[model samples]
Target chain A: MELFSIILLLVMGVATIGSAILALTTKKTDVAILAAGAISLFASIFFLVLASPDVAMTEAAIGAGLSTFLFFVILRKTEQNAEK
Target chain B: MLLSIENIALASGILLILIGLLGALTNKNIIRMIVAFSIFDTGVNILIVTFGYMPGRTAPIIDGAKVTAQNIAQVAIDPVPQALVLTAIVIGFGVTALMLVFALKMHEKRKSLDINDYTDLKW
Candidate 1:
């Protein structure tokens, strides 16, 4: 079980780093936003694996859901303003 | 030979912090920087949780049946970091939202997302 947990943790770490890199390097702001949110989601899972379910739920709800939606709203508003 | 889970978690947390710092530093766009900041925030939270972990320990919940007064500390992980992370997560969300609003207002005033463009306040 420890070995399995270690493997999962390593995998999650890689995924988190990969998504963060994508968020940084991506040209499109929307894609970057999504990738950033993915980092949060993955981190939430990491939190769960570390025996912190409360933090995991909070991360999922705020980091992935609320933050992503807020970013989208800001993006839309900015784009619309730019068009005008 | 495999490294211990604690070492693994710590290394990963450090890597995440470095990655976030790199992203935050290299990004030119306002929104991208804010996204990078969130990444950094998540890394910090992970580090805090990882630091609180104990090998072979369960969650910090107290059921009063399985986890009694005598063995609670031995069976459960630390709760302080979890509580700290909970507050940090909410605070991070609030700060990120405020940053996004600031970005919006900046765009409204300058019609650009590039941080370099906001040089009026710079000396």
Candidate 2:
């Protein structure tokens, strides 16, 4: 179990960094927002692996779910105004 | 040196913060900056949670027959960091919301996403 946990942490670290890079370098706001969501989701997994389930759930819900939804809504609204 | 779980998580969290700072510094678009800031916030929260982690302990919550008053001191990690991260998450959300609102207004006024386009405050 220790080995398994270590391996999972390493993989999650790589994935989190990849997503952060994508969020940083992407030109499209949509993709960037999604990447930010990915980062937080991976962090929540980190929390879970570290043995904090409640924090994991809150981070997943607020950081990943609500924040991403809010970003998309703002993007959509601005695009609509631009078209009008 | 041995690579423990905490060290690995700590490294990742610090790397994330650095990446977010780099993005925020180099990105000119307001929305992108907001995204970068959110990434930074997550990194900080990760660090906080990592700080609270114990080597062989689980969560602070008691469920079923696993954790009782007698064994909780031995089994559970600190609960303070969980609460700290929760507050930090809410504050981060508020900060992002405010930034987005500002970005939206700026975009509406300038019709441009680039930071260079805004020179009204330049002296």
Candidate 3:
């Protein structure tokens, strides 16, 4: 079980790193926002794997849901203003 | 030396922090910087929770049947870090919202997203 857990953690770590790289390097602003949210979603999974279900839920709700929504809303507003 | 859960989380947290710092420092767009800050925030939260992880222990939840109050210390991982990270997650959301608002205002004022345009302190 421990080995299985370790393997899961390693896979998640690799995924988070890959997504972080994507968030940082992506040229599209919308893609970067989505990648940042993906990082949060992956992190919530990490918390669950570490035996912190409460933290995981919170991260998923606020970090992944609300923040990403807010970013998209703000981005839309900014783009609209720019187009005007 | 073992690739335990805590060790893996710690390493990932550190690497994520570095990735966030790199993005924050190098990105010139206001929204991108905000994204980097959000990533940095997650890394910090992960580190906090990882430090409190106890191997072979279940979650800190106590229902008096599975994890009694008496044996919770031995049977469960630390709850304090979970609480801290919980607060951090909400606060991070608030902060990201604030930063987005600020970025919006900046964009409205200058009509640009580049950090170079905001030279209020330029000599």
Window of ten residues with lowest summed lDDT in model 3 chain B: B1-10
Cα displacement (angstroms), candidate 3, residue A3, comes to 2.0
- Candidate 2 lDDT (Cα, whole model)? 0.90
TM-score of chain B taken alone, every candidate: 0.91, 0.93, 0.94
Greater-lDDT candidate between 1 and 3:
3
Interface RMSD of each: 1.0, 1.0, 0.7
**Model 2 C-alpha lDDT per residue in residues A1-84, reported as the tens digit of each score:** 888999999999999999999898777889999999999999999999989888889899999999999999888878886887
Look at candidate 2 and tell me the lDDT of residue A4: 90
In model 2, how large is the Cα lDDT of residue B69? 76
1 or 3, greater by TM-score: 3
Residue-by-residue lDDT tens digits, candidate 3, B21-45: 9999999999999999999999999
DockQ of each: 0.81, 0.81, 0.91
The global C-alpha lDDT for each of the candidates, from Candidate 1 onward, is 0.89, 0.90, 0.92
lDDT of 1 by residue, B3-104 (tens): 667777777778778888998898899998999898889989999999998887878888888877789878999999999999999999999999999999
**DockQ-derived CAPRI band for the predicted complex in model 2:** high
Ranked by DockQ, top first:
3, 1, 2
